[model samples]
Target: MATSTLLLHPVRLRIVQSMLGHAQTTTRELAERLGDVAPATLYRHVAALVDGGVIEVVSETRVRGASERSLRLNLSRASVDPDDEALVDDERVRAGFLAYLASLASAFDDYLAAPRSTLEADLVGFRQVAVFATDDEWREVAATIRDALLPLIERSERPEGARRRILGTVSLPVD
Candidate 1:
């Protein structure tokens, strides 16, 4: 139940993604949002996350003779530690990346299933460009992108006109 092991699982990763930057939420709520996952399966992953210290139960209430627990991601314990990252083998990295790719594909499928007019109006896009830069320059580019997005990420909880959007980026060097 190491943080990285817990996170690398596809279901658990999806659960973490759904809970990121949000307030406390119940397992029932999670199951609802992840409508494709079985309730039992979702519950099992939630328990694993809780046991792994990646998430915690913030509150509990009795409802209809059953206890409903509200859980929140423990941001401090939700990342692969730098040292642990160095220890991850190639197989593990490949597995994690595949899981992420599967999720991305699923998201794209969902987008396509939506109304075509809505999709077109939303300014959605997928594109890639090759940029040549020194290592230091690449680091600066990454930092600048993060700095520009940090405010939007922080304001995700705003209840106004904000809509959910997924932004995915991958940078790799070609041999």
Candidate 2:
């Protein structure tokens, strides 16, 4: 399967998102985190990702009589490179982008559906920013973001009262 195809799937995208910032995650843990997805379906998507090289099984151990696997995402394979001619099928890529947006919408809807959702108190936010900058300026801004966020990304300890939040970034030129 194409990387874009594998990565942009709604369920698969959620699986990837759950694995982000962690060095490794177990199949059991994924099953628990994405409880809405059936174990069979989740296992299928995980196998597909493993086959596509989007994720790798780093270790395996037996829990009871069953085999348990520890997996990690290959971040390099988690996105589409439009410049890579071999991977660019215009329609597929566009569809994948739409699926990506749909996943974000679904996440927000889930949040709203939660009984105790308090957007302001929860610090939930989504917005669009339009920037006019030369390529170098844009690179600098991106670099700044990376530098500032990298530490948090690398932290393995979950401090008290620090709830997990998802952050998504999209940049596109205005035509």
lDDT of each: 0.82, 0.83
lDDT of 2 by residue, 49-82 (tens): 9999999999999999999999998888877666
Worst 10 residues of 2 by lDDT: 80-89
Please state every model's RMSD to the true fold in angstroms.
2.2, 2.5
- For candidate 1, list the clashing residue pairs, or say none: none
**Residue ranges of candidate 1 with Cα displaced over 4 Å:** 85-87, 116-118, 156-159
Question: Candidate 1, residues 1-175: lDDT per residue as tens digits?
Answer: 5677888789988888778767678988898878999988999999999999999999999999998999988878876674775336878767877877888788788888876676558878888898889999999999999899878766636778666778877788975
Runs in model 2 with CA error above 4 Å? Answer: 115-117
Q: After aligning candidate 1 to the native by TM-score, how far in Å is the CA of 57 from where it should be? A: 2.0
